[model samples]
Target: MEEKVYIQLKKKITVEHNHLIKLDHIAFVTGNVPYLEQVKNIKIYQITEQDKNVSVIDGFHLLDTLMVSYPKLAFDLIGPNQVIIEVKKQERKANIFIILFIWLLLCVGSAMAIMNFHYDVSMQEVHQSLSLYLTGRETEKPLWIQIPYSIGLGVGMILFFNHIFKKRFNEEPSPLEVEMFNYQQDLDQYLIHHENVLLKNKND
Candidate 1:
């Protein structure tokens, strides 16, 4: 009886440049087959300097290559039909000056946005009117009401984001985080589709 060789192809694999793309790097190849080590180390492709940063490898192509060398072995392949090999981009070290600059910019921008909104809606006049009704006095500035409202507005923002600096107030993801996660998922799917189309067009 032919020995069973299980192969679980990965959906996506990220790696560095200038490396031999091996079966072991892309999939999980297992089962007590003789020359299993050889099967796992099969040189499926190479990420050369000349090659593009992204490449797609189909499972069918991999299977055909394996059968040529080990026709006697039984293969059980699982997972997605194609695998994406992408070169991981190196990230630059964080600079404190850049971070501080961004922080200041955002702070100034946010304050200006809030002030514009308040001005548009005549918030100060509304507050003055409400203060006159409650305190039975015509006041130019409602510091008691405005101070609490300003503090509450800042607190509300923190609560909405569910984060304060690097610390998270809750386990649930914030709205911004959820949006970013969705964007990443969409990007991955697009990469798969785009790469597959390129391969098909090349074959044609």
Candidate 2:
């Protein structure tokens, strides 16, 4: 037999400015069942029932409450897990692109250096032959200036492409979507606990 589940809101309050303020709230769905039969059932029930008074307006409410109650904590519980996941994914892709860009710059720079060296040698040979036939000398550019110039040009091009890619592809999650994602996770966990409790009760 399929049993019905109930949704409940739990609220926790803390004293702020000498007045009681709702610290955090969690919305959980659970079925009425005996606590002893199911392991962790009591704890889940206590977590939900204890916070029943605080209204959960959005997923971030839980994290906001935690942040408000615990000032020293660094992580924001209000943000959706999906947002964190997406941001991490975006960063990974950006890093990969950055690495590829660097590799391409190195390959192109190496090819250009080889070509320039060959061209310089060819020009030198022509100049030597011409100078031998005439009463003139050949002028050569310094290697130090040429090498730095080529490197600077390659670096500048890579930077420009990186900037363009960031502008075109980089995206951050919106506040609402993050909240929704968090809410969904909480709701699912709550329902699962409730179902398990009901199932245990039915078996008993």
Candidate 3:
């Protein structure tokens, strides 16, 4: 009969810069730096090289940087860390007037597009007819109905985009937020795929 030995190493590690943590029954490693275990369950690791690097975003870095072997359990760990990132202050010079001009142009262009589309479809005539039917009176401009409809447009836009006022409606995501999240996911996947392709090409 053979004796069974079970050793379970942590598959995840959370660490901070220049902080010591208990890595008991687990061996932690990162950035090709050999991490030494102090005492029984104590481990110390330091973070260096702080500049805006794509590999490290904000103050967090994810690394599959741990390996431990005892008897039965031996695997790698996906270690993530929030470390001190020292960013060099680079003074950025920008033309604020130019940026404002472009923004104004965009707004004007969008308004023009919408107005042109509505005019092409004679939406004003539809509005006039709808207003006449609602008010049961022949008028040049339907100020009563049109005013409320205009107000409703703004309110509807706010509700559609934000879902609520002050507080949210449970866990349900707003239409805009959902669209933004989906866009972010697609962008991430696209960037990852392109990065892999670029790496493959470089290797080739």
Which one wins on lDDT?
1
Model 3 ranges off by over 4 Å: 1-103, 163-171, 196-204
All models, RMSD in angstroms:
3.0, 17.5, 8.7
List the pairs of residues colliding in candidate 3. none
Whole-model lDDT values for every prediction: 0.84, 0.41, 0.46
Against the correct fold, how does model 1 do in TM-score? 0.80
Please give the distance, in angstroms, between residue 158's alpha carbon in candidate 2 and its true position after superposition: 1.8
Poorest stretch of ten by lDDT in candidate 1? 193-202
Summarize candidate 3's per-residue lDDT along 159-185 as a digit string, tens digits.
777655667656778877789989966
Q: How do all models score by TM-score?
A: 0.80, 0.18, 0.48
Rank by lDDT (best first)? 1, 3, 2
**Candidate 2 residue lDDT tens string, 1-204:** 333323334432222222222222233434433331231121221223323322122333333433454354343222222110000112234577889999999999988887898697885566555555564544364444456767887677655444443353235544544788899778655544443322333367
Q: What's the alpha carbon RMSD for model 1?
A: 3.0
Among the numbered candidates, top TM-score falls to: 1
Q: Whose TM-score is higher: candidate 1's or candidate 3's?
A: 1
TM-score of 2: 0.18
Counting clashing residue pairs in each candidate, in order, gives 0, 7, 0
